[model samples]
Target: MIDETAEQLRERVAVELERARARTALLTDAVDDDDLIRQHSPLMSPLVWDLAHVGNQEELWLVRDVGGRDPVRHDIDELYDAFKHVRADRPQLPLLGPAEARGYVATVRDKVLDLLGGVPFEGRRLTTDGFAFGMIVQHEQQHDETMLATHQLRVGPAALNAPPPPPAGARVAGEVLVPGGPFTMGTSTEAWALDNERPAHVVDVPAFFIDAACVTNREYARFIAEGGYSQPRWWSEDGWRHRMEADLTAPMHWQRDGDGWAYTRFGRTEPVNPDEPVVHVCCYEAQAYAAWAGKRLPTEAEWEKAARFDPATGRSRRYPWGDESPSAHRANLGQRHLAPAPAGAYPDGASPLGVHQLIGDVWEWTSSDFVGYPGFAAFPYREYSEVFFGPKYKVLRGGSFGTDAAACRGTFRNWDFPIRRQIFSGFRCARDAEPV
Candidate 1:
């Protein structure tokens, strides 16, 4: 076993390496060599290039950072490296087989672990351009998820399956009743936060009672059974438009079979477990559900305050569990799979105020819009947040089971189009300034 410090670094590196391997397999497993060359959209790259691209990223960061021990493979520039080449030219490049590309990925990760092992955690930023070592760990994990999505798009439902649905109606009791005080909110550090989380500032909120756990399918059914979708007052105009345009009567992929509800996941159809967190519901769906329940979603500030500002600590944290990195027992992340785990599976990852599952399982919808913080600045990844500060998107906190533990930090921000429902998403509810 590795020591605590060494263990943390090793765990971080090992998790990425494992994800890289899974991604490579996912890309190659059921995909045909011909289909790999077809264009899906400019946003996605060819499956054949996935490993090579990951290898190029690893070489750029880990290998080059260690010492220019290896001149990157000559053709890697044309074959991968989106920053260097356009998607239009991807099919023309030579591709490496699963084994060879994964080998390169492994070698690079081993070198990063070796180099990181000797360095202290304090103030250790890996990139000369100011990217932290943590960012590299997170970058690889993000790529892993991309590969999963890519495979799912290219190969169909068999390519990716979500985890088992959580048990229905499982109630986790405990709520932090905030008195609705004036609290400082937003990002505070330049450490590793995205631009939108910057310009750290303050916001005063009224006291409210937020559900300890996210809303479950069983709870949602009560609304649906009573014609939640039929009620215009429960939905925003935009949400109603989306519902009508998409002809959505229930959560995406859910259907009514006979007198009961069934859902399709990972290519298989199963009975909806009413008590489990309602997976695949979009922001619009969550909003409607909340309104029907006579509650509302918490603002990002309210969510952060409940988890970060303690009567004792009086500060936001990198994680709800304080300043430490997450472990397997802490959150259901970095598990090399895209799915919402049980909400109560990670009690250890709870916030200081007893907020459960504040780190992972699913990305919780915050009432906040995706916007710039008070004094935001662009970094090397200039398009990161600046490109999405518009009104069509919303902010999601906590990470999903599909995320890397490193990316599951409390300060992390995930934004999505308000009506998009393809991701592993769910939501918790907040009530107006009162105890339950």
Candidate 2:
């Protein structure tokens, strides 16, 4: 998936722009002037600033940084170059007002697109500037998600898509039984894997049972109703403390309204669509729920084993269904611009072991911390792994609904701060082998 073609890159950028445009529209309508002023503080930028920032970063990195284009505005280099300094220092800068800043952003995006249309994609030097374009696309993608998260935080639940009604059929909860065997656990050379996924090697794993599907809202609610939130015994020390400090009684978007639970999703508040996968939960929350269910989150290795067929082969696949790219019907991505699709919507996209939606819909939580593979090395973006290899972060596999399929692969690993739940994140569970 990493070795995406130029056309794929262009399409990805266009889709991201559409997502940004939609979220911007929502923020514009939802945010009052006071809210806008508050959103502009050092902690977080206003929605207007966020929109402009996405456009500016794309233009600065792709157009000016790579294409050698002139700046659309003289002060752009000084007023809004977020990459020029430490990220923490960004919010403290003197920023432009909403109207002019937004206009400049629109101009920059148009110019960048025009430049992209003219540039030769295949033979150019894949230099710092070239990498910058990829980074900017990913950066804007991240902001699109953040905009949704902040909007939910500020304005209650919203769906990234139309919430499909609850699952019509009976829920199937079981595990895919894996036989004991030797597996090539690490990444291989066939794909554009990060350095952390390199130095591929073989690993032998014992027989295990993994969940057939990601943990669902219905299942998690049973835990909650059974005093899962009140019981410290179900939580790890870190998880317990996290709950106490945050006073989190439910998932980030979850709230109670009478006997049933409701969650803020995709720009609207709706009932906890019981059949949908439980989403936007942080690592600790997912862990706690797994514990409550008398199970554990799958290790990154286990997750990869389930999602990937031949680890040693290093077969580059965009989705678990093979080298095929994403489609609306294959999974819950890019469909009418919403949050999550129903868990079972993508039977055709299932892994060989029948793991549904492994590559799209939501990022699945893994038990493994984000560390380098055996014999790790660094690449051009040196900070990609070294700075985040510490204990606090964890690996998340499978791309979310908002991610481009090209960026989602068997070996394509994504890491996140354990407690950061701003993205469209969710989890599945695994359990020890049952006694014969």
Candidate 3:
């Protein structure tokens, strides 16, 4: 195992914290106060609320929890407490304006950085391994993603832009077979892994065939052309109800234009690219597409096994491409493209079994509910994961282009309601392997 020294770890933590702050700035700086305070959708907090909430969390964890300092702004704690206020109601609260929010986070960050320089690296799980620092960075980056979602939902002109992802290389047609076997499912030793992914365990999975790449716009278009939305047989009862109630004809921001499809992305309207992964799709949509294709969404176990299990080594890797960490060439991440790379774009990032784009491009919905593993225990707080353990939420594996590497891992778990389509989400299908 590679040993990271205290200084090395501290520098790494500092860099990640700064990167998170930079992303936050990039997302917020491009918008005006009106955009910041306005709630784009009932499901999301006002951008200003997220801005202040980021500071409040950093102050709570680093300034108060780790530093043992008095509260910086005790009066506003209730205002920014996420559990205390729902997204729709946040705009009604007296949130700090954009300038004030930026100043508040800056002050909080300065103190946190100071504390981090001297914090011991050997005591208390929260402080040890620089977990508190890492957690703060992850928290900020998550809010960055949420803010980006807000941007996507906003009605204004494009507020952000990046060069397009490199053109996809040769497409690997068809599915890869994951041999039947038990493989490590989660992580017991990933220092910064969240509570939900803790205490790695082995899971025995039957042989299955999973898509080599995420289902793309071209593939999904076939479902639409085949009257996927009109066919009740392809959708679950609840899923069909939600679809009918919403009257969704295509994925969010999509519309039939003449004989083709057009989509609004980051406030720009363009023809749908057939080769890119189909994103902004809800789990219900994924399920419907899978059903239409005579396949199924891979279960969480099957998805993880395909991404991490190595047949030759009989061990699991930290990432699909053997754990070396993500880069521009390996995966499309960190809002580098503001969109998914074309399907089959990152051959270098394929999993041991040659499953491509498993780490990035988009968050792939899985056919599993959000639940705790056996022997699970809530850490630091229960609200993080314990409270959400149930069938009410569906799981999404892998990370999206907006995801930070610090917060993403093979074991990282993301969950949401089955009907949520505003996130950057997509899916790849799977099926039982045929008997020899």
Candidate 4:
């Protein structure tokens, strides 16, 4: 993306926008209209709600905000306002039917494509490098990931499919050392980076050792076998309380199949592959597992250091592999696979210090809470990230198989409640290292 002129940015935005819409269509079109109308889970919006909501956002940002056009459907703006309705109550509203939602989104996208042809990219911060357009692309992609999770939560058979990722053929080490010192922690240069990841600043991190690959199902099973959940010592007071209240005995979708454990994904039930990075484990579960293994979850700074920092260059890169961008050979991203590849897959995606799969396969939970870096300033809108900066939400780094390359980067930060296990989440362990 080097020396990308406004023209190239516009093209990139268009391609990414189309890619996102394709994915959105794939997710929404896979299921029946009844499924789309029904809320798959209380924690997620009805599929039909998501279908139209993305259109409203596109119209709000691209058609209206950037194009100075009238609202496509000003009457329904409140209906699609995410803050206005909880996921559980979304289905109760007189929501757009599946066909109507599809039509609305398509209408908005057509208008957006027209605006993209001539939108100025130099006059304002939002249009600088087509930032607003990029933001909308990312928003839709993020919703695509959300809708994929909705599919996973649906009560029917698998509605989506993708080939499994590569096997963990390369024997990976247990952990890797991240040599630490003063290194830039955030990004001031990533054109599409969100407010929280902005105004890159120096962070003095100490040396630490992090899991070379994510904590796999095999590794996590050991924790479960060792009375990990029943034992309170390994869990924090809050974690133990929640574990008991939620009756969380294992990762979501996992159950005891005769002679071994089985996992269900997208309605397919199969024996859990021990080598795959464990998914659906919340922050508390990840933290407890780390404690059970005598390790700890990496801080956001440590995770980023292990991910983007290169000792030789003494600088940060856009991704683990490099500033170039994600590819199938580099990382498992863009929903190319339905689930995480076996641990140790994607050796090419490893960080310079030999930290593998740092960018994708699963969203690795960090020990850090969601907070803005120093000198952070909200641009375009404060609701994007400013409203969520608190100790309540834990930050997760890296992307998942469902995460699009256009939306995820080393500086891209994701956060959720610690007890929410419905998302595609996982973890890698880390610990302090003695000075060499």
Residues 181-283 of candidate 2 have per-residue lDDT tens digits of: 6666556553334567776777666667888778888888898889988999888898889888988887776889799999766557778777778888889
lDDT of 1 by residue, 225-301 (tens): 89988888999999999888887788877899888799766555678876556777789989999888888899988
In candidate 3, which residue ranges exceed 4 Å CA deviation? none
The local distance difference test score of each candidate is: 0.68, 0.68, 0.91, 0.91
TM-score of 1: 0.77
Better of 2 and 3 by lDDT: 3
- Give the Å error, residue 296, model 3: 0.5
lDDT score, residue 341, model 4?
Answer: 92
lDDT of 4 by residue, 200-242 (tens): 9999998999999999998889889889989999999999999
TM-score of 2: 0.80
Regions of model 1 farther than 4 Å from truth: 1-52, 59-132, 149-170, 173-176, 182-196, 199-202, 336-339, 434-436
Q: Which ten residues in a row have the lowest lDDT in candidate 2?
A: 163-172
Q: What are the per-residue Cα lDDT tens digits for candidate 3 across 1-436?
A: 2579999998898899899998898999898889989999998999999999999999999999999888888889999999999999999898888888888989988888888878898869888888888788888988899998999999979889999998888577699999998999899888888899988998999999999999999999999999999999999999999999999789888888789999998989999999999999999999999998999999999999988998999999999999788888888888998889998889998987889999988999999999998778888789989999899999999999989887788899999999999999999999999999
- Deviation (Å) of 206 in candidate 1: 3.0
What is the C-alpha RMSD, rounded to one decimal, of candidate 4? 1.0
